[model samples]
Target: MPIVNVQMYSGKNQREKDILAVAIIEDVSKILSVSEEEVMILFTEAPHGK
Candidate 1:
């Protein structure tokens, strides 16, 4: 399993997060030669400069 961590400022909505998840799954699946379901993504939201 491939674990990916993504950090961003805390202001994104559900749609944006969904879009990012889809895109990340696609690219990671291709790059890692794994299925979309096998890839794991962790989204972290924090204030700027944290």
Candidate 2:
């Protein structure tokens, strides 16, 4: 199982997040020779505030 963690500044809409997730998953699957279902993708959206 391939686990991927992505962190980005919070400002993306739902569509953007969905697109990003799918793109990341596809790339990881191809690189690791694993199915998209087998890959784990995590996105942490953080605000630029204290």
Instruction: Name the weakest run of 10 consecutive residues (lDDT summed) in model 2.
Output: 41-50
Please list the Cα RMSD from the true structure of every candidate, rounded to 1 decimal place: 1.8, 1.5
Error of 2 at 11 (Å): 1.1
Cα lDDT tens digits, model 1, 1-50, are 99989988989998999999999999999998999999988999997674
lDDT of 2 by residue, 1-50 (tens): 99889898898998998898899899999998999999887889889797
Q: What are the Cα lDDT values of the candidates?
A: 0.92, 0.90
Candidate 2 regions exceeding 4 Å error are: none
Per-candidate count of clashing residue pairs (backbone under 3 Å): 0, 0
- All candidates: TM-score: 0.88, 0.84
Candidate 1, residue 23: the lDDT equals 97
lDDT of 2: 0.90
